[model samples]
Target: MNFDSYASDVMAATVEAVNQLTPGHARGRDYPAARPDLGDLVGEAAVSSEDVDELRAYAFKIREIFVAVDDNRIDDACEATNTLLAETQAAPTLSRHGGEPWHLHFHTPSERWARGWAAPMATALAIVLGNPMHDRLGVCTATVCDRVFVDVSRNGTKRYCSTACQNRVKAAAFRARKQV
Candidate 1:
């Protein structure tokens, strides 16, 4: 698979991290009780409690990239992503792990958990933002959720993070119609 595919996964994990870490008043602090299973995608090792704290803090900033793009503020989105890329000191290198083929990686392999994760994600967003596919990034339209999403649908009409959120919205609309 292309290394760019990892960018999609990075966006997904970052969204989960943001939504779980910063739920609105309607919900209590729902910061994920545990680290998300990004192992398969990002090859995350066992993270320390310190790593979790750093990840939580960084996730909020990552979410801003989607929110800015969704709001049609392309410049803002690019600026934010650029700042993140700088903060993480993202640098590209090629390496092969185990039996896998060589692929591009951003950030030093010896970096801390948070730096390792953030660098690649920022790099990926920078790549997307620099291309015509920038519209693929979005924040969920669901009022109750602010999770980020990538519109991979053919027509790119996606507005919610997942079917669960879409169903929730549709169900609410139905209830409103019934009341009327």
Candidate 2:
């Protein structure tokens, strides 16, 4: 099966959800506006404000996984992910929907909004951490940003979460050089 697509897509959505749903530099942003993209992770699932709040709590847990990885605490990351996997009761299943071809999915018995999304996300993350490419997951290195990302670049050298953050750092360095 296409594990790469699963890992990349879920991880990207995880990043978006965490950045938009949780507080930090991206706090003041609108989660509702970002729902379209986030919806890819949970198709057609109904979510309410209380559901969003639960998701916001899940966001914090996901962020901890990224922080552990970024901090070079691989064991901690794995343990945290394992805890989430157990909590969410994530299990693999074959699902075909919307006339799409049959493919793999991680499912949880709980119909709760947070666990619904958390199961697949945690499953994708477990797949990565179980492999050598676990380092591909990371929290943005920008001091001003706590965003998380999956480094899918060919060289796997990504540090910043986005080009905007990369450019901001570059511009700051240029200004510093001029002053020096």
The per-candidate count of clashes, in order, stands at 0, 0
Per-residue CA lDDT of model 2 for 16-103, tens digit only, reads 7877776665322223434424555456777777777777788889889988998889999999999999988888888777789988
Tens-place lDDT per residue, model 1, 2-102, is 22677776666666666555444212123343535444433537877677678767777877778889889999999999899889999998877778998
- Judged by whole-model lDDT over C-alpha atoms, candidate 1 comes out at 0.74
Which sections of candidate 1 miss by over 4 Å? Answer: 1-4, 25-44
Clashes of 1: 0
- Candidate RMSDs in Å, in order, are 3.3, 3.5
- Each model's C-alpha lDDT? 0.74, 0.77
TM-score per candidate, in order? 0.83, 0.85
The segments of candidate 2 whose C-alpha lies over 4 angstroms from its true place after superposition are 1-3, 26-43, 108-110
